[model samples]
Target: MTQEKLFASFLLDQTQGVEIALRAEQVTEATHIQGGIQKLPGSVDFLEGVMHLRDDVIPVINLKKRLGFTPDSYTQEAKVAVVSHFNTRYGLLFEDIKEVFRVKPEKILPINPALRTDDQAISALIKVEPGKRAVELLDLDHLFAGSNIDYTNEEPPHESTAKQRTYSRYVVFSSGGQEYGVSVEIAREITFCREINEIFRTGIVAGAIELRGRTIPIIDTQALFTNSETTELITDEHSRILILSAKNCSVGMIVDHIKEITTVADDSILPFPYSDNDNVKGMLSRLDGENTILLDVHNLLCNHVEAIKSMANIGNHKEQEHEDSDTGAHTVTHHLITENCYLIFSIGKNFAIEIKDVNEIIENDHVMRVPGASGCSTEVINLRGEVVPIINLRNFYQFDTKKKSETNKLIICSAHGQTVALEVDKIVTIYKQEQFYATPSLGNQLRSKKDTLDRLIEFLNDQEINEHVLVLNIHSLIRNHLQLETTSRQAADLHADQHADDTITEQAKG
Candidate 1:
């Protein structure tokens, strides 16, 4: 018999009730934060602040604010739930935790589409008792990454077995006679492609289209599918634009036509072939013996834009390589590993950094704003009494700038012989050599464990790392990006320079 699991139910406000369906082993700590949370200056509203919990400083998140609810007054009755997964930890604030109940997996149901949004944080719904409103299930990973999740029933799946299985609903479309589908959750709404102001010389950007009083960039799906610079898409009567939301950015994709929404069981989705380079998640075989290509819209957009940027900088990157070697910015041969472990982390949906030069992972390091450092070089954090510069790789990498929460972490490492830190959304997983295989720089892809590296490349945009973690060259990161001094003494000088006005005033008075 399958073991029943325990779920913790809680109230966000006085009205709506929610539940976290994770196993008991998943929760690390659940208690009222002593002395309350300390607010950080300039932090986002959803981030309450950092709290010293046990040995680590944990970021406490305001669940109400995170869910777009009105801010609730602080009270001692509130509780903090610390959950850990993939070696990453975060805290979720609750107004009042209700009850812990054991439930068989089959009892949980997908929330009705009529009552949910594709961008909602709730992952599933559970019926605690008869005729009661189902408690929404929260997905902590999506919540921490500031990702929108859809957990509604579009078309109910055919249950073939007694075992519990998770399913996703997708909207099918076709272009160039080829069938394609995208998760209905990410694909917000479908509408006719009209009044699109084509931007000449903008590469793949078809033009700006007004979406609910806001102009957003639109990309041609044909260009994305073919991995080309641009494609002449006939946006006549049948052409439709799929509005997609990933992370904090929203984009529109021009498709021939959206067919219908269908539910497919998770197990039926097969990985794409190794040689295929398109942004396909999997292949779903239908009853009529036809297969539809599952599209990963987020990766499709990211890869197309990145490829254009890479091609534009072809000559510049080669020139920088020689300079990097001369300046000793190249990673030392001794630091390279053939068979070892890597710490994988993500900045946004598109890229995951593989840390080969990781020195240590620490939390609660107080970040001090650095003087004269603009853009990515924003602050210097004190790590074990040593000052290390903090670089938000998202800013350096030109990713979508979402509201950052306190749960974000600093990855400490040595770059150019200097200790530096890279701030990432979350630490995904620590993958050993056998778990992942390295390849020549390809656009971001995830490898599934069930299949070999070659066969699993087709499943690149599933957004979930299975057995194969994409190995990002840390050497390139240290050499090409992050211009900062390595030593704490040099960082201290920068910090002192930030307060030089006060020193001068004191000297004049003396």
Candidate 2:
């Protein structure tokens, strides 16, 4: 006789009737509450007290608290589900448990993007009945893997399962007649469009959605590809919104429609051709003769992240202006010093740079290759009848070379009469002298000589911004580039000298 596959799910009264399901085999036992539940000390609030079950003590988790719900008193109908994963057994307290439902492996849907934010607690989704509510299939693997839980001693699931081939799941969707894919882990949930409140003066932010009391900015994926302000997406239709969590902010990407949810073997994914499209992380072919472009959600939200930050600064500046108007100005006894302004940009998610040693910004035109120059200074461009060498900062920063884009701007600057052009992805706002405050901690990092991250970071003041902007070592950067150029010239001279010596030795032998 063949065994049957089943999924046990429960209802959470606190979460507006949202149902969470777990694999039936993973659930060891389920018991009704009989006595008082003990409280735990020095633990997270969601950790319900240890209770005796089956002659052994097991910690109970308050499902409401774990899922960000209001605390509720335990009812007589409440039951606890004992589940174990990675050798750690824990009990999950539920409002009520439904009868076990028989489901096949293919019937379960990969978690919808609408419910996913930053974690993969809910692994799958299933429709109980047509046009009825959907139940979320919970993955204890991710539930315990979060910061709230502690299971440090247990070995990772991959360590023991290494012999078995693993495939990464990807959520495939369509955009502008092209297929796109995002890793199932990072791709949160798929949601329908809601009332989108248009934000004025913010770039790339198509609108904002008030979801579950949190305001998430929406970026029209079609607008991103077309580079046009007019996103013809009808807000009222059955528009699908792919919610992505990156940089600790929830961003909703508006796609045409979700095509399907499937898994692709890791080895089968092919590298994307080199292009200026950083948004396209990679590509893979589907069995149906179609290529799915893997989208980088982080890159798509990069500009919006910075823009949102700058918007906060603008808000602070306005507030400061209003406050100053309300109160009369007074002369200060201490002389206020103005700091040098800096232009900010980022290389990746974490690395950022501020340039004070720049002259003028211009569009990147045809760059001529300098054969004998160093790797970092191999390209030169003609600007106003003068040939200027281009500095590829990625080379010095050890970042992969990104393809050039139309939006990429070159910052021209000179030190000691030597000029160079730096290519940066996006140009952040200019920080005035009084906008930011510098800490000697930056100087300490450089003086210590132990850490590679030596860039100075200045925290913005009330009249400036909310976050810290990294102040780059422009002087050091230019100096290093010049040093590399000099070293390359010296190496060329040495090679020429060795060649001459070899020729003379050959002539004498002849």
Candidate 3:
């Protein structure tokens, strides 16, 4: 007997409705259409603009229009269903999303070849019991056949190129009754205002909050601009934290609430007449007759270095306590000044590598495919004058192969004087003042003997939560996993020279 399969049902139109169902496994999530949509030039007719979904910018397609039906007016119940096809995610705009239901094999009926048309989107139909309406199963592979919609390569306009002006999106919020805007590139995420642990109550530093595994200092924007002292922190339903990244560190700023994510033209911004504050970059005049103060995020974060350092100290202290309790091991306290830095990135999951092991980080561009090099690396890129091998981390880790997008990054790392590039999904962030711990017994047994993951590191995510990230042992990875020699001629000569120097110093002391 065949097992039943689940399907997510939706309506194309409410009045003259056409019910459709997509396989539940393909649908990632259904979310409200927020921040509206930004139309793209030279795009297909049915390709509705793009919308920001958490960390990704997805292209929304009007399902009604794509199916030769007029799109209905968007109402409060309208939603964008995020679906995955070929490991690439896209947003399907629908009038309304119905419930997910199961269809038994007996009720599933395939469409006849004689009745199918050239543009047949319905592969099968589910006959409901009694008098319920039949649901048409959607064939996503056929619907998006030969479609070439790329939304990830849009780049921001450069300041020097005045003729090629493009629209830049900004996340706008209110602070101290005045609205301010920050570029979407720097704005990490918007989260609810959590209770802050007051480590430093001076100036605009309201306190600190544990986000993921790291402690981030919360800056009171009202106090910063007003030149006033820190007041009693208050919270309400509308309060939010606008997490901003600068200098490879994240800091949360308290805002009244997130108003909207909108795009502003490059020429639309006017220089601020007042020069009292360097943080205020420009002014954006909106249609509602209000001027939004565009802020320089880098300057704002750089000004609060002291507060940021204090938050890092708090994180280290808490991490030490956690480690001691878990392993019953009392480790020596390490100061923040001497702490090591790491580059955090994601392949399928989060992983960390020491920053010192990295030579540089570059974009995954112009990679040439090589034949018969499929074991560890199958692609190489010309970095400077050297032909550097590109290791697909997903393939090496045995993760599902995903379609590479423009946002993918390449990390140039070296071990034993041999350099290679690691292809990753995206660079998450650079973490400082972090500690490394030994991998647990269970992890050691599960991992391969030649695997690179021998240690664990912890970091905080955007949602103020902490998780363990596996640290890559680059030396072992090169020697054991890649079967490369542990030492180059130059490295061996340097090691011998160091030993000779030590012996001569010992002879002099004797």
Every candidate's lDDT: 0.59, 0.62, 0.73
Residues 204-285, candidate 3, lDDT per residue (tens digit)? 7786777656667788877777767746667787688877776666788888856655566777789977788778779998
Query: What lDDT does candidate 2 reach at residue 364?
Result: 75
Better by TM-score, candidate 3 or 2: 3
Residue range with the least summed lDDT across 10 consecutive positions in model 2: 311-320
lDDT of 2 at 106: 59
How displaced is residue 183 in candidate 3, in Å? 2.0
For model 3, which pairs clash?
Answer: 211-464, 212-464, 212-465, 212-466, 213-460, 213-466
Q: Count the backbone clashes (under 3 Å) in each candidate.
A: 1, 7, 6
Winning candidate number (TM-score)? 3
Deviation from truth (RMSD, Å), model 1: 23.1
> Global lDDT for candidate 1?
0.59
Candidates' RMSD to native: 23.1, 26.8, 22.7
As a TM-score, model 2 comes out at 0.34
Q: Please provide, for model 2 over 1-510, each residue's C-alpha lDDT reduced to its tens digit, 9 standing for 90 to 100.
A: 344456666766735777788886687655555355667688887787776542356778887777776655567667787787766667788876554455556566796667785666777787655367678878887788754554233344576565565677666667888988887667555666666755322346675665544456677777776776576765434357877767565677777755554545667778866778788767886545678888787776676565443322221222222223556764322111112434556554223333334445566778788875666678889987888888776665556778888656677776655677877765554444444444345443234321323444564533565566555555665565565566778898999999999999999999
Top candidate by lDDT: 3
